[model samples]
Target chain A: DAGITQSPRHKVTETGTPVTLRCHQTENHRYMYWYRQDPGHGLRLIHYSYGVKDTDKGEVSDGYSVSRSKTEDFLLTLESATSSQTSVYFCAISDFGSGGPYEQYFGPGTRLTVT
Target chain B: SQQGEEDPQALSIQEGENATMNCSYKTSINNLQWYRQNSGRGLVHLILIRSNEREKHSGRLRVTLDTSKKSSSLLITASRAADTASYFCATSGEQFYFGTGTSLTVIP
Candidate 1:
């Protein structure tokens, strides 16, 4: 799992409830990303953090928010969960240096089901 | 929007044979990366090819990129049952955009 860990490996929640998923990394990489994987959509980036307190939106950032208060922790929050947001979430870390291409290492993933 | 698209959504091959998968992207990219996922678990980075580079090799895996055509191909030689997984290509520029993945089944 590349020293990356996601809390609440599996969760079942009702629509309209708030949900928060945690991604912690011991690698202390410079870049961290949150992604959701669905049957036909593959993986879609939700948000990414370049450093502590520096975050940016991704292609699929709607209905979701992210915060990186610490270097080793990145949090993804669903203000109000919806059925459409039900998917497998994954956290990935990358070292983005000049040595080589930025290869991402991913966590085991968290499965979220909204009913 | 997704930047990459892969063909032959599903592939079935016998062990000891070779497997090949293709990926096409819409726009220019700094680099392209291939990843493999077993079942529905997390993705594992396989190989990465830069735009300036033509091809790269890692163990039994070979990857080639064509910048002019905005495409790439991944070839795995002497496939084994353990190689059965979903393969995806991701393009990186300002950010990473992943394709819909190709499912490879290596029958032992």
Candidate 2:
């Protein structure tokens, strides 16, 4: 789990409801990422943060937003959950100087089901 | 837009045998990384090979990267049942992209 924690390990929510996933890391890594894994799609990056208050969209950023107000915490928000968004979410951390580029340490995933 | 795609969606091999998986990317990358995930768990970092390096080894795992071909291969020697998992390759450039994965089943 790499000193990283994701809250609400499992959740069941209705479609159209808002949902938020939290990723907290004690490693204080400069880079944080949110990814979703599905049966056939593998893992898709939803968003990433390079530093506090600095964030960027990944390939699958639609319907999701992210915020990094503190160095140790990165939040992913689903403005309105949808059945298509139901999947296992994972959070990962990495520091460019600490290791090499993209030597990520991942947290246990959160299983979300939207009905 | 996944940047990397892993070959052999599923693999089954007996213990003590060897297993190999390959990943091909669409664009140039600074480095390529491999990760393994047990069922119902998050992925764990396995090995990383830089663009400048051609081969890397860690224990029973061997990774080779060919920058010219924009591809990489992960080979596990003397496989064990405990090595059964899904392996994914990720490419890093201006952004990171991950392939679907190859499910490896090491039979005892």
Best by DockQ: 1
On a 0 to 1 TM-score scale, where does candidate 2 land against the true structure? Answer: 0.97
CAPRI band of model 2?
Answer: medium
Cα error of candidate 2 at position B65, Å? 0.6
Tens-digit lDDT track of model 1 for B34-63: 999999689999999988899999999999
- Tens-digit lDDT string for candidate 2 (A3-100): 99999899999999999999999997999999999888888899999999999999899999999999999999999999999999999998784334
lDDT tens digits, residues A35-110, model 1? 9999988899999999999999998999999999999999999999999999999999987756344989999999
Listed for every candidate in order, the interface RMSD values in angstroms are 1.9, 2.1
Clashing pairs in 1: none
Please identify model 2 stretches exceeding 4 Å from their true place.
A98-100
Docking class of 1: medium
Best by lDDT: 1
Q: How high is the DockQ of candidate 1?
A: 0.67
- Clash count list over all predictions: 0, 0
